[model samples]
Target: MTETVAVVGGTGTLGAPVVRHLLDRGASVFVLSRNATNVPAGAEHRRVDLASGEGLGAALAGATVVVDTANSNKGAEDVLVAGTRRLLEAGAAAGVGHHLAISIIGIDQVPMKYYRAKLAQEAAIESGPIPFSILRASQFHQLLDMALSAAARFGVRPTGAAKVQPIDPDVVAARLADAALAGPAGRLSEIAGPKVQTLSELSRTWAAARGKRRLPLPVPSWGKMGKAVAAGALCNPAATTAGKDFEEWLRHE
Candidate 1:
């Protein structure tokens, strides 16, 4: 039997690759977003906003599995937590069998507000009636690059001495697509990069790649969030590693 998979936030960085993977796996793929104009041509595009719940049910109707890679950095509460609640309700109503949500690694351990929102998002998924699987991954290489570039504007890069195990989006997307196909396994194993590199090292490498020179500044994090990140709580040392390291990714990408 053919599987119909609905991918929320399918046009975003992480979500786009998952959509591609699902399509490559021969599943009938639907990309759900408020504006799906940029969604790839191979999959069906459904314009639906999770926050408002408009067209959500119709978009998710008859889906065998739903992969939620949706996220909002500025509106984490509205999009991550509350929007997930809305998705869960709609999925349950649509008789969706498996719900696969991609989350960040160490969200429960981190003290940041965004991490807290992710925790709430997880709670909503866990308590919902639908059978669900949640996969947590470390920071993405793109995100790390963005961070380095943003900090480089000041002529110095400050990383707060946080250690990151950054993974490729395509690798993370493939794993999530596989989990969606395999059905709900509850919380699956976390995925991470091959090496645990400090933010300073990543920033320096990124700067060098850009043909720019900047001093690596190790800024101390004072609060609990700082402590957790500094302690490497965001990294899953035991998780399976995938894709190229930062240097290799930079060269190819």
Candidate 2:
């Protein structure tokens, strides 16, 4: 029988891919989503709201692994901290074997609100009764796309002069699912893409992909340490992982 795994908030971008990755590994997967929407075809979906810790027990029951990809809309604290703690408690009660989580590289270096929440999540997972594997990766190229879309809102895209090593989200999803399936290894080595590119450069390249122009906008800090991010916060890549690069992902190679 295939092992069962529950993925919290599996309806979103990162979580959706993670669910697909787990299913590809032959694991019977359970996905929890906020709305009754976009449920993965091969997986079971439980309509649960993580914000209130509602309906988590029924979804997590009898699972070998529970992965937290559920993010909070109320801010990082609600999702990363409160939701993670709740997941840990529920998983512990359910006798879940492992808890897998994804974090970004500059959680510590950047001092952003999201990273701060992620750090709280890491701490919560570390102290959990269940075993856990925490994986840190750099930005996803979709972030560029999201930014571009936001800029398209006002007929202008904002590109910052920051260095980013973007890996394919599908690759990250596959690796994390594999790690979760192989049993608990605790915190894994940080993972990153092969090439590092500036936001300005990547934005331009990505805009060209969408038949748009790239416009770099110099702005002050917005998040926790925005200036620090502009100064290259996520600077190191994991020695292992050896994932594909941005160009490779873009070319669909």
Candidate 3:
């Protein structure tokens, strides 16, 4: 039987690429999203809400594997933690074989609110009834861009002393697809970028690429969060690292 993989949040930055990869691998791919308009071609799009758990059963029906790339920075406790619980319940009921989730590296070590919610989310998956694989990845390039752009909007370029390994979302998507195909492997080795650089350096490089001249201010208010960032918890040196460097990605863009 051809494996049918349902990607929750399949229209997202990381999820969309996973959907495309599954389609290329000859798997029957179902993209579960609230808005289905932007789903990849050759994949079935089902309008469903992960937070509300509405219309999830039909979206996940007959799925061999389910990859959850769903994320919500706002109300992460309700959306990521409770949302994952809802997904696991629906998956177990629907007879989904394996459940795979994408998480962030160092979420356990970080003292931030969102990271705490992600840890809670992982716990929910761990205690759930279905077999699961959780793969933690580093920050995406877009996140850095978004942060810098937000600061730029306020006429300030906020750089930082913290470090990050900004991996490509496409690369992260490929690994996620591989995990779904390989079935349940428990908590797999993390995935990160090829190079580790400071957030300040990355922001300056990004600024130069975009021909923007602004003062790069080191964010002093990161507080304990800054300590976590400086500790290099976000970079997994032992994990399988595959992706272009931040500067390389910037040059291409």
Candidate with the greatest lDDT versus the true structure: 1
Clashing pairs in 2: none
Superposition error at 58 for model 2 (Å):
1.5
The reply for model 1, stretches above 4 Å from the true place, is: none
TM-score of 1: 0.96
* lDDT (C-alpha) at residue 107 in model 2: 78
Q: Which stretches of candidate 2 lie over 4 Å from their true place?
A: 220-227, 238-253
Between the candidate structures 1 and 2, which one is better when assessed by lDDT?
Answer: 1
Q: Candidate 2's residue-wise lDDT over 120-198, tens digit each?
A: 8999999978888998888887776777678766677566667788877777788888887888888888877777777
What's the true lDDT of residue 228 in model 2? 69
lDDT at position 89, candidate 3: 88
Give RMSD (Å) of candidate 2 vs. truth: 2.6
lDDT of 3 at 58: 83
Distance from true location, Cα of 127 in model 3, Å: 0.8
Q: Is candidate 1 or candidate 3 better by lDDT?
A: 1
User: In candidate 3, which residue pairs get closer than 3 Å at backbone N, Cα or C atoms, i.e. clash?
Assistant: none
For candidate 1, give the lDDT: 0.88
Cα deviation in Å at residue 158, candidate 3? 1.9
